[model samples]
Target: MNFGDRVKEVHREILSTPHGDLPQEFVTEAVWRGEAAYFLGWAIQLFDKPHPSTFTDPGALTGVLQLLQPDANELVPSARLRAHPEIDDYSALCLLIRHLLQLQEMQAGGRDSLERAYQSRLAKLGLSPASNRLEPGAADAVISSTAKDSRGLYVVRSLAAEWLLGEEE
Candidate 1:
């Protein structure tokens, strides 16, 4: 399969499972809660999938976009996405990766621009970090799982960021 086709293939696989296939149970639970549907759609975007979704869900798109951030540099493509955009909407991936990076920033330190964007989206979702309902110390229960999975979430999100945000202008 081609790069885009590979991405779409994974997207279908990930979306097939209602609970997702994350490592930890909590992380899987969180993904099932919303992140899976959300992030899967994000992956589809990078694949250039047409008509991702129009559901009234909030975090759905953000999670996907967060994963889709094409977060790799010039060297490699993020696992979530096959190849970084060479043609259209470079900034689109950047914008998405920035959010995932914010999750890492929150995990590593505290607040920053990424956090601001995450907060904005969280606000739209009617969720809050203050809630502290999920695991991994952040409202985003998936973030910790992403960090936990070296070849899984962490690698994928990093790739998305590097591929998207770290790409040269």
Candidate 2:
């Protein structure tokens, strides 16, 4: 299936279970996949900005559920999309989010892995530290944002600043 179809299918399965009673595993998976959805949502113009609160606030998560519903009429046609650039941005953001999350978990070698990924992805997009597209201490911001609230949304938000904000300009 195409990515749109897959997103719709996953949205169905995720929303099938009511919010309050969702298993922890299900919720964890949702947060991870939801990061992708946030990218798709931007590509399709369903979202103009990433809502970081979706990770911790039930009400915000409910709003995302509403927007991402399979039959939601928010998606634009694929013909209108600049697919390659969006894909590059998505990949870069994915790497950034993964690096930040690993750092938050105090994982060893996160910076080294991130540097490698930056060379491969962010460098091409002019987002490497040399280009100044990626702000300094972005990982620290995510870590601080989630210190009290260990939800994955802060990582999403940090990467959003790197990507979605650029889309606006």
Highest lDDT: which candidate? 2
In model 2, where is the ten-residue run with the lowest total lDDT?
73-82
lDDT of 1 at 148: 39
lDDT of 2: 0.52
Candidate 2, residues 40-145, lDDT tens digits: the string is: 5555554554543344344454475355455344433332443555544444454575565665566565768766755665555554543344456654564455
Every candidate's lDDT = 0.38, 0.52
Clash pairs, model 2 backbone: none
Q: With candidate 1 superimposed using the best TM-score fit, by how many Å does residue 24's alpha carbon deviate from the native? A: 28
Off by over 4 Å in 1: 1-111, 129-131, 135-169
Model 1 lDDT per residue over 108-147, tens place: 5555665675556444433343223333323243333333
Against the true structure, candidate 2 reaches a TM-score of 0.51
Can you tell me which runs of candidate 2 are displaced by over 4 Å?
1-11, 51-74, 78-114, 124-126, 129-131, 148-169
